[model samples]
Target: MELNQLISVNFNLRKPKSSTPTPLYMVVYYVDDKGMKVQAKIPTGKKVHPSLWDSKRQQPIMINKGIDLTTNQLSEQAEVTAYITNCRILVYSEKNLNFDEIKEKINLKENNEMSPVTQQFISAKKTPKATKAMEVVLNSINESNKSENTKYAYRKNYNKWCEWLRDTKQVDSMKALSQLKFNEFKKWLVASGATNAMVNDTCGYIVRIIKEIVNGEGAIYGVKEVTFKKLATTSTNVKCELLEEEIEALKDTKTISEREEFYKNVFLLQLATGQRISDTYTIIKGEYDVLKDDNGNEFIIIKNKKSTRGAKVKKSYIPMTKEVSDLLQVLQGNELIPTNDKTLTEYVNIEIKEIARRAGLNRITPNGNPLYSEISSHYARHTVTTQLSRKGLTSEQIALQLGNSKEMVERVYKHETDSDIIAKLQPAAANTPAPQVQAPAQPAVAKDKDLEYYNNLSDDDKLLYTKKLNDYNVLKDDFFKSLERQPERKRKAAAEAKTREIVQVWGFEGANDMEYKKLCFFLDLIKQDINDLILTYKVYNDEAPQGGMISAINDYERLLINIGKLTYYCHL
Candidate 1:
């Protein structure tokens, strides 16, 4: 249907059963595919009676009889025009348009325009009215260029909060996101099946959005409508990691499907590397992923994908163990787990839990509980972190091992046990050097006596001896480096030999006096040409008259070539 030629819209007053104001109803008329005239009715959701409705214009008359644009009543009439325009757009659309899509378009446009920041500068007389925190959040989503995953997380968490709020009928708008009510919301989220971490993350996103509104640095929210304090919802530690034996069992257990096996290998690699599922599952064994140290040892280097805007991305090189190297070899020239992260997580979790069951490593606690209550993709990380912690690795070291921040290791990875200080106090290894029987050289000490004395020294004395060892090593390196160079006498001899070869090649031994005189004349001319060329360039540019320095240089080169021929002729 040609919308411009055939389509038209008309508005009719909706008659209420009683004598009361009712919204205008829209009717769209166009020819159908079968060449029959058709009409569709859609509600404008704007209240107007028979007297106010303009049937010919098919638009509602100004809702306000007054001539003021600033009046709230005029705003309502503007909204009616907005609705009518939305219907006209739908009627003119080339594609078959649905009511839902039209409604969504209107809502999206309204939400975009409904920002407090946009309204703030419009009217300075009145303080900006606070909207819902959700509105601010939705606006941020529309404006944000964050990664899809981060945006999804923000929207998902906000939706969950919205669901809870709608049930309680609290915090339905930005004006209600006050600190006191927020505390109630936070408590409600926690009580309503949200784990502490979930509640913290969900509430934290809300708090951050609220703070952005108050700061007015980016998108502004309405002026503070209600006083509120920040929520204290820091993420709590989650203590579910695999033990050594459990990890071993997971390795030993086998799967039946290639897909399951793919996830299993992915899990093993993640466990070994402590990489996130995003990095681990889609690993490609290419040259860029492999790093070789100065000593030529190879490592797999990975940079995490979870970095904040303007933050330095976390990256680490994990030394390739035999198992990891073998795994890479198997996955060589192929993507090990070529699938989405969501599917990879499901396969890994399912196969890993089954593997644990088969190995009878499900639980081994004093209370007869399993090592992990639920095995998920993150278990690989938690397992690696906890095991490294048990091996006496520091938070910084663990963070590097897992490609994460030290604060993360301190908070989430560490499962430290009580230690006895006495156990750490042990005798240092004997520093006594092996005896050397040769006579003492100059600047040397008695080897046997010195070694014996060093062995009996205290910690401070031992530190001094260690420094001496370091100095000796440095001296040894310098001595070895010196071996690559020649002495001054040999260098001078080599220079003289080079000069002899040059003179012999010039035919000085065979040239007659006349030929030598001719060569000297050419050399003098070439030298003079060089002098003139340099003077010409220094005094003036090539554009100056008689300033052909480049041509003079070319002539000098031709003379030098002739001199070389003369030397060869003299040899003949």
Candidate 2:
């Protein structure tokens, strides 16, 4: 039906119960967006005798004194016309407005008084001037630089909140989203079978959007700051990861069915990329770049769907190791890329568990769940993160490969226990010699052993070491200062090689045999060099530093871990 035919109104006479005049009644009927018919009858409070009523025209006839409408009757006709116009505007403006809401807006409950809309219409103020947080959120999502998936998630969360309000017969307003109701919403999601992580994410998005709407800088909405209790995550620390051997087993297993083969390949692709299932699927579908650096080293770069909106690290740069390159080739050859479907994760999760079981990964986790039972597409990321951290990649390097923040990698991705730490350090401890008692020294000239070691070096060796250190510093400074004059790729590669050479020449074996004072002194020098490079790259070049600069900084940060010092570095 045409939009103009959506609503109709008619004025008719009331039932003739008395001999005197009968009042006029207004009937409003319309078809809502959901194809439901709605109607309401409103009394006009103006009457005409039967003889004076013009049945055909539906108005009082102008048959001299007895038929002509009185002043009050004339006013009633004008008010009814305004009501009809206001009703049309409301119906046209709001596609989701239901009949009950329309009745309230048009004053069906208090028939004698004009509704807020009708009153505003008569006063020529048809539209109200106020911002609704819900509408603001929708508009913001539409306008944001967020990926389509992220935008859809935000919209879904907002729509779910609205649906809950409607189901609970509560008003849809910012004031209605109280702390208690927010908590209840979390419970409701879990009861509805959502995982604890899903519940937390949904709630977190809602809170973030509402907080922006209410308290953001220069936000003119008249909403108060929304404060809710921090929800404690109830998710157990179940080991949702496959062991290295288990992964290899899955890789070598013969698939019993085509579905198992497809999902297994998909899972392996995820492990290679260390991406979310969505991103892994995207990469397989060829929505990625395989570019080679000046050293002819190929790497894959992808715009992370989750971190596309004003994120500091928007792209994941994964070195194209033989494993990753070979897997990509196999996936391409077999046409094993997943379709872009919302149910892809669910399907992959379900199928991969059976695949794992078939491959003999039947170990149980500490949480008492079978390892295959805990296996899912997401575990690929956890497994990769843990494996990379174990292989001595610093948090920053892992974060770059995974497209996550360094802090996030350390706090959430690198999963290690106290025993794991002890196991790693035990070898170095075993190699160190026990301290020996020294003969009594003269009280006036107690020697600093670390300083003494530094002074004992040959004069020529000291000069060469200083010259190499200064040359490395000058190279970094010149590369940054002349960034516009040279090919950045070539300059960066050279700078990186020089950095490695300088570190190698120093022969600094961290934490194994170095004394505490000597370690601190060298650590201070490394820290100073890192600071100088940061200033050169960020302040002077006005561009973020990458590759070797990041490697050096990460090395310094990791060394801090052995020394039990706080790891602090510039965000860049």
Candidate 3:
């Protein structure tokens, strides 16, 4: 029988009380290997008014008395829906399990939402290995130099991972950190509908934490190695930033409540300082000086919350621009924001979007949504980076202001339009086309010495270097085309040949040293191209290209790994 035919699920109200809420139960029916029909009745630990549940749909009805659901009502419905879907996935994915085992798994997952006393009782029953592993992970997180908010996040995710291990894999926590179980965990996350960015961070943190554990005390955990491959980073939302006018509008806007005013101030401060929402708490809560140099240039030094553990410079020097100075003046001697960091961040995220929406900042996002809907505390960092670049600050200077690496600023924060780039170059050569070398009518060996080293190249030579880079990119494009079309038998050889041709054109064979200018420049140029390729492949996979999607995704993952390596080496 087909998998879907083998397993079926539906919901039932236990008491079917008309006027009040009642417990919800899910019934799973499946046929065992011996062809015995079996049923597992699992309580969802959620309740809804019997009238609100649609028996046919096994979902909560959204309407009563010709009215739309309230926000809280909608949230409760969503939670119930999520629970139902999760139960279905569990039943279908584990069809091989007998009725009793399936019931046990569902019960375990459901217990996560049970009362505090029940949850504690269930937790106490976990294996000693699981408890020890949790201890190691939590202790390591708390003892680390990561910010309090970051530690909180890590601990929360680690607990979820542990719960997942217990419920789904039915294993000790130490085993979940093993390579095989970690891969399963990734699959589970994807199945659970986690966004790409969420899966990336959640999995990435777990991998890092485990490595920290093994590196610190290898004997405590049973696993000798943890080599979990992380997923490619994908933009999960439209890239957006506020305009100068929008910032002004936010400044001019009136707030009805102290809370709204407080959130608005926090957001504006984020824009002025380019700090993470978490780091901004440090700036506000602590006593920091806005000092001046001998030249009377005002600046504030911020110890970046997320900087490397042993970096030489933990502080970023933010030059006090008018925006920063004005905000500081407004906030001076005022009572500090009366909220914790997490609540402050959440409130700011909500209020800032509403404020932008009300101000009529209706710019369309790249994904065709209104830009105001995409505004968040993090967009302030992007705005600051782009603004600094437009104002002609060097990359190094912008990095100092943002307290991040130049490569990171370029890769993540900077979002310039093509027109902006063209405008920046217009003063130098507005009308000049990209310099190109004349191709001989006959195929000829490309000269290696015609070009000076990239660093010493003249303007014309710089353009020619770009032209050569384009030539390499063109070869890469051709390689992908060929890879897409080649017969399965010859695809491997075709891929190797095309890749070698591309690399050979770029002349990366001999310049492998750190001091090699050509190698560094070449890597930097292709990093963006590789990123584009990953995104393109993602789209192609979604469209289910004629070439196997698995193959495309595999290639995409490989490109992701290579780019990660290249970025690392470039930074070195």
Candidate 4:
């Protein structure tokens, strides 16, 4: 029974003489703790039934007569040893013995007094205090009127913390709940692999339990008020906005037959309405108003379900662009948004990550985790408001569309229109061709060596040089065409065209193709050029023919140039 003694114990089933074939298990032990070879036998036959000692309720239970200690069972040995050491220390302290002296005395007892050691060993076998605390915590949590998911999470985390506390702190007395000890417990909790947020939550739960105990509630417990240090908030920079290229990539992702149509419709709706996954799922066809304003300007009243219960909830009035209406038409007859929120959010997040990965926008954190420089679905609202604000919508106007207050609009939507206007002006300057620099008067006495150096190249070298120059020109042409095809470029072109119309009305000539090209580049400087163009011209009240003319001209020129360059390159 001594902490240092070695023994082997085993349980055997036996029947009593009076018992009618009722089987029971008996535990036998061999002790070497006192250096006196001794054996103890205890009968755990059916004659003794398990009982709840405090409540006098009979229950079936296994009796622990003794434990066999071996080096192979190191964990079990450690547990038994800790219990014995804690008990001996408590007894020795009460007797006013020096701590080290008490340890030495206990170590000496390995040679004598085997019965007292056995008694102490048996006493320590009682159920742990944490087990009781856990029961109380679980019972309280179950009885509370919390959400099922919340309750489940609380139980799981509470059990985890209890296990960690038992193992690390070796808590026994209720007095250990003091603030200092609680701090130590928290430190151990963090060290035991719990995250900062998890640690905070677990500590919060523990505080609640302690409060109940201190206030004389059921299974009252007390601990010193624990003051936990706040963990630093982990800020993430996730890009939530769907760029034109990113949207294309998502659309291009291959889908299975089972989910192909569903996935496509879901993504398209997100792009069109910028609705969060939760709101997107509940959007019904009737909730949308397809009527036009007094000026014949079409708009959609997106009746928010969260706000429809007459509880002063925010609601948004999104203008139904042709693109959004078309998508809704495609998605008709679906009771839900065709996908669950988690699945849709996860898919979009994965796609966003892949886009960032492909675009070389992935950044590394100090801890070596990949940090994305964008937001997630949670930031979709902010991105929508910012995008709308850049289109010359006032804060009040955006607030009305976003179902938020103007104060919130100004506070959250930080995209500045003035900055966008300045960005738009850059292309105009670039397109205004610099005065053709006049060549310096040619020197009559040019060096003959320089002229000969250029003239002495071989036919093969000349051909290679000419081909390289042509390839360079072809690449330049393709690059510029891509810029022209960009949506932002179209917006810039339309804005410039509007400016040119004003100039024309005052007898000024419209910009030539070169000026228009410059405007395209300027428009490309803005984010989400294509979507912005669609919003600005197509959504707003610009004449279709005029708007179409500008977009079509740019598209046609780009196609022709690209085709011509490809043909010339192939022939070369």
Candidate 5:
């Protein structure tokens, strides 16, 4: 099955950078091709010290503060492990599990409302041997007919692993990868400041590559089994769908900057089609792709490039609304809001938050973060699926529209809301008995106990609490800022050095004249992105606004291409 059609589950610290104990939250996000988001955070209700969490494992490390784990820490670690296991079952299971059902199972086990699930371990046997890096790469490529995008992601990750292990971990041989200390490898990857998701995906690539080598012809060197638990990057709530009023406001906006207007139009286009980032960019200046039916109706028919390479080729057709049809007419000569996926994603994410905030969609998350905190380009797909679901489209119909299976659509695409549940509580017929109670609301992050107490305090006490909270945030920001120190090098020198490194490692040595220019062209995109960041963040006097630094890093991730997929394999 295509990954985009399924939900993604991860674990993360509730307040990772905060210098306080925070509960772990499980984050689930995925596009429900029918235009609904399966994104949500499931709280584990178990807290751990900020330092003890492990990025690659998404589970806590057994050791703490350079010492063996304490009894309490060990208990929390087990709970985290089980929470992840159960979450995986829910997300990956054949049975469709909704958020409430998943939450109920976990809560029931926790509150002793239901019996605990017996944990099961399924082990795979494998023989790993000495393997040549390039040989394994070739085997991985030839053995599977995955999409270029998927292969690029894996190959790029493999490239990073080769660099880090050879440089930092001091591995003597990539050929003997299984002999290396896997835990140490994970530690170095985490310490390099990768987010939980980044580290997890990269490590996952490492394991897959190594396993493939062993399973192929590389089993001559030694016998070994490879295994890992996927990392969890959790979040509690999402800024789900935009309210109809908010959508209408964007449609009716009169006063806005040109750039904002551009993004707003793109956002509307996204909602109309509900395509993934890569697929949406397939849109270019074209009336050619738009077609007329026998009955004189119009529909968009685009090739779905995001699917697996071996999947039967098919065109996705979206019947055009008058709105979509008109939007396409206006998009004729002008560049789409984002020239590429990188800029497009960044531009949409940043603008939507402001748009939603300005349009009065500022519902606060229970965790005290802005509801808009995690809103991004992908939210558009969720918005579309949600609107369709509410319109009473069947799962099969929604799946066909979105190019996914009905089971997945039904599993991840949600039409229900709190209001829906409330409506069900009303009597449908006079003869029918009304249920005594509605389903209990989904569990929410508890308000901070101390803050709750402070609110109940006298006015003078409340004033003191605000002062203290500000001081805490100030100190925390300072510490996070300290963690972001740049190396001591001039920008020109650094850029030159980076170019040299990229060329040396990423595949430029054998580049013919044409290939060389393509590599140069790619590098220029990064340079432009960096320059744009300088202007956008106004990093004057070498001072980095923490927010800008973070936003820029994420945007850069979108742009960082794996040219290695071409350069490394072209000659071979």
Candidate 6:
């Protein structure tokens, strides 16, 4: 009988009592290729029975006597069933049966009939060694002497590797494990579309597992040694910077949105004070002081929260310009902005990049990523230093204001000296030198005819030409005089006006009451004289009543120019 026939067979057996006559009811059937068939019935439940060949006498014979039952009683019974059941019975012919054919048939039948979960259980039972090894590795990872997070990462990587090995490589027995085999597995990992970082991490986990198997309590489990070729580090192409126009454009955006307001204030504060995002978010109200120095020059003091030990500890004391003061006033009421350093930095960087993209300032690198250039929130400090340098502040002076070393200012900032800055800041030389008039030189001794010709010209024509020349000369004189007075009187006048404004705002009662009061009075008097000059120039230029008017206008203009120069000096 074939295995397929045996799959559907059902049978029963019985043995007779000692004294009772056995009832003959059992039946057997067999078939042959020659169309021959046979059937037989023997006394049922009889251990031993005889063939009924003779009528007068009955002969007794063992049930297995005629059959070729070479093996044990169980084998004989199994063979009888195999013969009667019409199924393939390879187990009866185990020696002559093809092992591969039998295995294939068995596997096919099992696959067709078994549930998925049952199949998994059979597979697990078959690979008990590999399963036990995996458990040991997992246990070692759980009891690792590393940080909690590190252990967690290791376990995650290990589980992933184990799953891959089981699913793809069909890795089970200890003898199948090898470094060469693992190298192939690594290639598969790359082909499996894992990222470079992921591949590295997975390989790292495998290596750690091998190490643990070798050195950890799981050393008894056979684990092969692994050597991996290190993967290259991927570059992080991150760009963060604001453009000049973008920074300028931020000033015009005035939405009441909290994010917008936060960004604006943060940006303005950074630009004004040159503070980092980290330090800017933590600035308290009381940390700033708008006060005068010993020389009575007004300055803004900012105590840095991020200062470390062994560094220059001086607070950033910038001069309180109108722009800076206005920004501070706007931010005065809020306790803190709605962001921390990391978020603000990231937000500003993203917005700056977006702004650059919108403004057509987005620069692309050779590799097609955004190029790193232009201004950022952090660049505000450099901008301030550069602007101050442009305003003719010395490196030392800037360093003092920024609370940095002069060497740092010169090296990192590349700050120019006051003289160098002045050279750049000065206006290009004006054309034609204020329209000078050339006086006619005396003519060489002329013949009598030449002299007679000179006398023949009309007096009206000569008078008109002379007046034009004189007027040109007068204008030229006044222009030079204005230039000469610019460094002194005009600047002084402006300074005095600003001083008086400050005093009035502060409501000082009298000039002699305090040093500040005296300074205010002096400044006011100087401002009054400068104002009078300006007024006189306005009056003279408006109505040219007489020749004296030109002289007065020129004088007042000179005084005004002087006051402007004096103001610059006073600020310094």
Q: Which candidate's lDDT is highest?
A: 3
Off by over 4 Å in 3: 1-235, 332-339, 427-572
Shift in Å, residue 163, candidate 6: 37
Q: What is candidate 4's lDDT per residue for 153-257, written digit by digit as tens? A: 566566655665556544455655557656776887767544465567678777766655555432333344456666654564433334444455445544433
lDDT of 5 by residue, 159-181 (tens): 66666655553424433375345
> How would you encode candidate 6's per-residue C-alpha lDDT over 1-572 as one tens digit per residue?
22222112122223333253233233333332344453423222223222311112222222435654222344434533333322234333443433334444333334422112345434453433554665687786678676444564566566556665655545466533457656766777777655465578778877767665656533343455778887774465332333444465455433334554656666677777666666565442435667897978778776666666888666777767677677777765564443356666655653443333333343554234433223356766666676666555678988777767788777776434566545765565521133437766422121223234323437774454345435434544554354445554464454344444434433334333333322333344334444444444543353344434344445545554553454445444
RMSD (Cα, Å) for all candidates, in order, is 31.1, 29.1, 22.0, 23.5, 29.1, 36.2
**Is 2 or 5 the stronger prediction by lDDT?**
2
lDDT of 5: 0.57
lDDT tens per residue, model 3, 1-572: 32324557888999876688899988877665667676767786679988778888888877667758755477678878776777677666664665656556566643433222344446555424644655677786798796655775676578657656655635465555677777777887877645455567678778777776677553444555566665665355756667886787677656655656777888898988888887777777754567899989998887787778777656678778887667766655567464566766766776786677555566777755566666789989899898878767778889987888989888888888787787776665553445548753321112234423565767676666666777886786787777778766666577657655665676555225333446545555555455445544543343444545346435644654553465466556
State residue 475's C-alpha deviation in candidate 1, in Å. 60
Residue runs of model 5 more than 4 Å from their true location after superposition: 1-239, 253-255, 336-339, 365-368, 418-572
Stretches > 4 Å off in candidate 6: 1-246, 253-256, 282-286, 293-297, 335-343, 363-375, 415-572
lDDT tens digits by residue: candidate 2, 324-372: 7777776664544444635568667766765665565667676555576
> Over 4 Å off in model 1, which ranges?
1-237, 282-288, 332-336, 364-369, 419-572
Provide the global lDDT of candidate 4 against the true structure: 0.48
Q: Candidate 4, which segments miss by more than 4 Å at Cα?
A: 1-136, 147-153, 159-185, 188-199, 210-300, 303-315, 319-378, 388-397, 404-408, 415-422, 427-572
What ranges in model 2 sit over 4 Å off?
A: 1-239, 333-336, 423-572
- What TM-score would you give candidate 6 relative to the actual structure? 0.31
